[model samples]
Target: MLDDFMTRATLAGVGTALAAAPLGCFVVWRRMAYFGDATAHAAILGVALSLAFSMPIFVGAMIVALVMAAAVTLLTGRGYAMDTLLGVMAHSALAFGLVAVSFLSGVRIDLMAYLFGDILSVSHVDLAVIWGGALLVVALVAWRWSALLTATLNPDLARAAGIDPRREQLVLTLALAVVVAVAIKVVGVLLITAMLIIPAATARPFARTPEAMAAFAVVLAMVAAWIGLQTSYQFDTPTGPTIVCVVAVMFAVSSIASTLRRAG
Candidate 1:
């Protein structure tokens, strides 16, 4: 039987994988990997706010992430290069969050844990929060899948079809925020975007359809989480980064195999 901590940690990691994988399909399709990083970075600032005000960390992270996503969407679409905007926003949020967390008084914060994740140390309450946020994201994405795919393919087409592309974008944005909030516990701020993007990228070669890519991404992510946990346990490495490293390796292997298949 798994110990309680191991069980909670497993659940936390798996739940995070479940939410991040499918939504990450949209992130990959939209070429919004940097945007995801921006939101995840903003989550660190949310942590500061939550710690300072004694609020729930999940709530704080979600609110700040949503605001950041909205701000980027509003500011970047008018003649600005979104890639540049997202890069600026992502790094700026991380820097500001680190500085702000340093200034918090009274309560001590685990800087490294928030930066690199402390999955093995996750509490039962944190487990509940993680699963809750993950499910909400999954449900939101499932509900809007068709509309989102259409908008992602062509916003003008979506508009002509009477679908408001912006609304679908907002739905994705909301789901992303929730995923970032919950993922902070499993993979921390710096590595959270990798958890979203890598598995999806790895699955891309094997998947003919968006749905297949998403399913494969989820499966790959779950495997990474489990293997990463075991690897970290055996080597006494950092859990979150360990998971990301495993995912990165998988991506490398997939890329190589895909290239060889194409060559043949």
Candidate 2:
């Protein structure tokens, strides 16, 4: 099964979707979409670091993503606006990463692969990393689901219940970093947040409970992955963007259905 490139690509997409679904719900609930962008954009710097230092891309990306997330979390309560801070950090990190990549002389690199992904080129080792990271994220989120939900719903109420909202935020930060790291090869830096946000958002209108929403998101993400791969393969389009486009279409259809239901 691993001998086939399509099989590997499909599994890679599924693994990334599994990790992103639950975390994406939290992103939507907390209105942290831009935050996801910031962390994902920082992944370019991670790629640069990995190449320069001769380390694994996942380790380098995870470390840089964690730093970016921690920086945002720490600086959020300071003077600068959250949006302003994220914009500056995200763009700056991406620019620096690109410049840094340029500085690596004699080493030919395809920036497109890191920027937009090369999922078809994924190997057996890559599959293992993706699945491992996915399972870890799922377990972490599951372990703290109740506390995380409470914190997301009402930080004050969470505090009243002795669940520290800040701690839950940290868990999310860690999970987001893991997703970005593992998903880099699947969706690349530019589209990681899309994989995270789109499925969850699409599932939103149809779900009555948080758990239901997450389950629907997983299903929708899986569907998008499979369909997107087929579409991209048939048309020879960029796979990562095609996947995102597919999910965006799903979101549009879901929104229309929701609006109609409300009207009816």
Candidate with the greatest TM-score versus the true structure = 2
Name the candidate that leads on lDDT: 2
Q: How well does candidate 1 score on lDDT at residue 138?
A: 83
User: Against the hidden reference, what TM-scores do the models get?
Assistant: 0.97, 0.99
Please give, for residues 1-264, the per-residue lDDT of candidate 2 as tens digits. Answer: 799999999999999999999999999999999999999999999999999998899999999999999999889969999999999999999999999999987777789999999899999999999999999999999999999999999999999999999999999999999999999998899999999999999999999999999999999999999999999999999999999999999999999999999999
Candidate 1: where is the Cα deviation over 4 Å?
Answer: 1-3
Local accuracy by lDDT, each model = 0.92, 0.95
